[model samples]
Target: MLSIEGLRVEVEGKEILKGLDLEVNAGEVHAIMGPNGSGKSTLAHVLAGREGYQISGGKLRYLGLDLQELEIEERAHAGIFLAMQYPVELPGVNNMIFLREALNAIRRARGEPEIDALGFMKQVRDKARELNLDEKLLKRSVNAGFSGGEKKRNEVLQMAMLAPKLAILDETDSGLDIDALRIVADGVNLLRSPERALILVTHYQRLLDYIQPDRVHVLAAGRIVRSGGRELALELEEKGYGWLSEEAAA
Candidate 1:
């Protein structure tokens, strides 16, 4: 569903992603594990079409279309969702209204009718419950007063509601405790389908234990230096990323 080849990205004249390459097909879950400053989040943001990052080299295609050509909203309408590492707070904006408008906009772009208020509320409530997110938070501003775990669950809630074709989750497990992690993972697992794909950018292997990835990649020095199966995550957990960095340097 997504193709990235030799992708080099720079922020403010400094390169973050250097010659990174990855391919994620439908029905596949890929985990990207790396230490600090390895450009994991850069890849996720670039895939989501976030601006300010100069694409210095290579191509990124989604569903056979050049992703760089699409605007951020266009990317979202095209079924690309990025659950950010830190979900921003939009004070004074009702969470439910924001979600409904966003979902309706995507639906409208797809030539589908907008969901009615009742339907939207029901769907949001159901999804919130599934994610173990407090229904009351929907009435508040988006992530305004939410705890770290709450914010992460809110991100997953958005993912569940949008039903994107390719979901890029950047550190969804970063601040979550075991309980919150399981709830978020279950929500993610529920969205898994033969036609959907997920790219999880994480620092720890614990997240992979809940949502088993088809492939695990060690990204160091801005490129994927090693790719393997679930066992790769286990090995990383046991050995850490030092070995991978040394190997990549060698």
Candidate 2:
């Protein structure tokens, strides 16, 4: 569903993604594993059309569209979702209200009719149940006073509701206990379909143990240094990223 070639991104005066290339197809889950500062989050941000990162060179085509030409909202409307590393707190905003508006806005952009209030609530409730999120949290302010696990669960709930064609989850498993991690992973796994694709950007192999990604790519110094199957995550867990970084530098 997505294709990238020789993608280079620069922040400030330095480059973070250097000649990176990646392709994701429908129905496949790809895990991006890397050490700190290896540009995993950068890739997520760039794919979501976040500002400040200059694409100096490369071709990024999403479903045959010129991805770089689309704005952030356009990307979302076009079925691209990014589950942030740190979900933002929208104080004074009702969680359900905020999500409904966002979902309706995307629907509007796509020339679809807005769902009625009752229908929207049913949708949200269904997705929340899928993620094992409490219905009470939907009535509260978005991410306000939420625990770390709550925030991540909220992200997965959004993913389930949105059902994006390409979902980029940046460190969604970070800061979660084992139980919370399992819940989130189960929610993600349930969403896997032949028409959808997922990109999981993470640091540890623990998350992979639950998600069982179809492919694993080790990113270092802004490039995918190695690509392998699910066993690669196990190898990385056993040997650590230090060995991969050395191999990349060599």
Residue pairs clashing in model 1 are none
Cα lDDT of model 1 by residue, 92-111, tens digit: 99999999999999999999
**Candidate 2 accuracy as lDDT:** 0.94
The pairs that clash in candidate 2 are: none
- Give candidate 1 misplaced runs (Cα > 4 Å): none
Model 1 residue 200 distance off true place after TM-score fit, in angstroms: 0.5
Q: Candidate 2 on 44-128: residue-level lDDT in tens?
A: 9999999999999999999999999999999999999999999999999999988888889989999999988999999899889
Error of 1 at 13 (Å): 1.0
| Weakest 10 consecutive residues of candidate 1 by summed lDDT | 42-51
lDDT of each: 0.95, 0.94
Q: Which is the leading candidate under lDDT? A: 1
Candidate 2's TM-score? 0.98
